[model samples]
Target: MTDPDPFRVIFVCTGNICRSPMAEVVLRALAVQRGLASRVLSRSAGTGDWHLGERADERTLDCLTRRGYDGSAHRARQFSAASFAENDLIVALDRTHERILKAWARSDDDKGKVTLLRAFDPHASSMDVPDPYYAGPPMFDSVLAMIETATRGLFSQLEPAVRAPRTTLRALRRPDQEDLP
Candidate 1:
């Protein structure tokens, strides 16, 4: 049977305005393209509260727009220990965020759920998705590209489990009725 609940994922960065939001929207767009939109849930947060309640950085939004993904609705929020109970996966944009998240984890399970976003990218030279906050548009684009590659890899790993269960239709027949030819 198909599960009714969606698989929740939350992306984290130093500030919710950059890398994490980019990853969040990229993953959402990918889920939709792969037909797993209903089963997969994507969200983002910051390791710190510096940008809480603020929208994603304009450059981040611009990068997403150029790539055909939407980031207009994203609002910055802080990642807390309580978030562990709400998300199945907690993706950190960099090693710093990962370390912070791991420290906040209350149990082994919570610690296991926290991981670097680039961990899924087999070709990744580094595990961290660089922060492009102070960089120019070109850097934002580069970071978005990195996030896209890693997010795609992550989605591939999740596809099998999150995919809707397939079922076949059977013709109903009475106990005494012969099967249809």
Candidate 2:
């Protein structure tokens, strides 16, 4: 069997303590459910280093856990030019983070790879995944709902690109009954 092509994705927020980490976990769960986990790699980072080396905010972990997602073993990290080169897609949690990524991008090609996480949501015109850290639990729930919807859309868009053409061709082949006899 041929090795599958891998697609890397990075989610970014201000501190990597809330929005981005949540997005990473939610998207990973969605990808696994859709059987794209092995074809895709997902991680999260902060636009700044404020929370580098620290776990996601307790509230974020609690919310994710309650929603049936594992939030363990996540440590905050900062976005870097290397990550831009490594990731096929760099998703920013808000406009500010998007702009920061664009500014840090090494080239036009890298800049083009950066996008707002909410871009997949037609209803979210601003393309910003609102920060729920300062809000109540309901806000976090809302963010998760948005992330789930967007992640599903993202997976659907990527499915065709990652599907193995050989598999499809094999499935389309039919046996000759006369030859079998």
Candidate 3:
């Protein structure tokens, strides 16, 4: 577990308005379905800030709404060095996002906390969730399907760790200090 708790997670992508926000809503919905909603706090941001303060892409909203997931309130934002401390897990939607996030990690432990979203998928074909912005409506649908499958797997992976009991808070071990455990 990391400070502020083990269940906080952030989804990452190239831009917040597309894949990452979609992922956030999908995972949040899954958390609710799995009875982990109150225990798991899900969020999202992007590697770039170009769309900051903007709503999620309309295509994404349509796909989520039509699929019974709520994504109406998302606003774009950029992932930053500060995010490393705020989230226990940083889930990158693609390999590129993972690399960008790793560059912000202050220590090896922070780097370790960052993982590709599809890594949770037991039978994933590709690790990257393709950006749907440039493509047509069908691509947005494809993104939704991919996010849904990955988030389900992610929820299962984290659920046990989240449900486990915890001791009193202790400051997270620094990179060098982790070897002592």
Candidate 4:
């Protein structure tokens, strides 16, 4: 099979302190659980730079910790055009983030990559994943739940593309084995 191309995904929100950071950790953990860590590169960012150098909110960290996710190393960062170029999918936590990303998008292709995170979930017909930063701990839990569900759906959509390259590589190797005989 041919070498697999890394599938890059960036989760975004208003400030990296809360939702985005949580999404990043959750998605990373999910990828690891599915044995897709080496096949995918998941990260997070914010539309604003308010917490650029700060760690995730204490409440968010605590919530994630309770769920067995480590958020100790999460440092907030802002999304950039460079990130858009690097990621295959740029998932926004809400419509506001989607707008910000769309505005910053350099081309039609870039805009196409930007989408609401909830849209990935077949159950989230509402299209918005409410921001939980201001609403406190319970809100964080709700956001986490939605993100977990969406990530599961996202993985389902991505599985085929992720495996295609590996399949091609195996096909190529089979021919090489025949020549060795």
Candidate 5:
């Protein structure tokens, strides 16, 4: 049988050079680790266009590499009102981005899609994932750690839901069509 549609998720931050890209990479890696990569499409964008077309910060790349996640191909893009329709979830690195996204929403459903990344992290002490752009490498690593923790939590919650549509579709197939591709 054909595969089901992948669940689309986009991470948003101030400039797309630090936190959001890290969250994107972390979440993608987690989905792959859990064998849900085919059922989840992860991406990232900035709340502002200042860094559009630029790669993630060097520190962000280094931290991701040290942890075995790839951030090499990330290019900055801005989140727009149009983005609300493309992603199933709009994850914000901080409350500020969350507010911006929700305010840009055209409907209640679109507004509801916006959430803070740390909301998934049960042990998190803050809702915001701080930007490490001007900070040293150590701070970048620390931020990445926060992203990894929250992303793992997010992936765990999404796994079963990602698999549900395929399972239901297969069950609804006729007995005679079970062997059909």
Candidate 6:
């Protein structure tokens, strides 16, 4: 069986530079602050390779830094089958990434590993986190808010496994399931 502690999580989006990396850094910081750093591993990637080696967008970096989050060192990477094999959970930023990831699933279990990031948010206004790639700085800020909110909710759902490693992996619900933590 897979190790229950250090539950792995990868945030995925179309470009990796904006939404996914932001989620990754925020989740990592949140996990560290909440004392779940060692029990959770947060990371990110893009569905496409267009910006494979780029740093996050300048606006994203500015917003993170302004919020005192460390996202400066994030280097973009493309999501692959290996990413799925490595992480316990793969979180898609929006419906497009979700559909692409679902198409790339190698097994039922792998497909189950993939879920929408906002699915964890009890108060998410929409099923997808809107892409802020083309928007102004304000949009990035707004999306950052969404990312933080959803990360809190996601960690809440996963906290049981951190506290009691015996918590079954099956407790993590699919995006379609609405069970609250």
- Model 3 segments more than 4 A misplaced: 1-6, 168-181
- For candidate 3, the 10 contiguous residues with the lowest summed lDDT are 168-177
Write candidate 1's Cα lDDT for 98-147 as tens digits: 89999999999898788788887888999988888888999999999899
The candidate with the higher TM-score, 1 or 2, is 1
Q: Count of backbone clashes for each model? A: 0, 0, 0, 3, 0, 0
Q: Which pairs of residues collide in candidate 2?
A: none
Candidate 5 vs. true structure, TM-score: 0.90
Pairs of colliding residues, candidate 6: none
TM-score list, all predictions: 0.88, 0.86, 0.87, 0.86, 0.90, 0.91
- Cα lDDT of model 6 by residue, 1-181, tens digit: 6655678899999989999999999889978888878878899999889998899999999999998997889999999989878988899999999999999999998998888889888788897999999999999999999999998888887876666764655457754687766
Task: Give lDDT per model, in order.
Answer: 0.85, 0.79, 0.82, 0.80, 0.85, 0.88
Model 2 earns a TM-score of: 0.86
| RMSD list, candidates in order | 10.8, 9.3, 4.9, 8.2, 7.9, 3.0
TM-score between model 1 and native: 0.88
Q: Is candidate 1 or candidate 6 better by TM-score?
A: 6
Q: What TM-score does candidate 3 reach?
A: 0.87
Residue 89 Cα positional deviation in candidate 5, in Å, after optimal superposition: 0.4
Tens-digit lDDT track of model 5 for 1-181: 8888888899999999999999999888888888888998999999899999999988899899999988999999999888888888899999899888888999988976787888888889999998898889999999989988888888777776787875543211111223445
Measured by lDDT, the strongest candidate is 6
Q: By summed lDDT, which 10 consecutive residues of candidate 2 come out lowest?
A: 169-178
Per residue, candidate 3 scores C-alpha lDDT tens digits across 30-69 of: 7788776877889999999899999999999998888998
lDDT of 1: 0.85
lDDT of 6 at 39: 79
Candidate 6: lDDT of 85?
A: 86
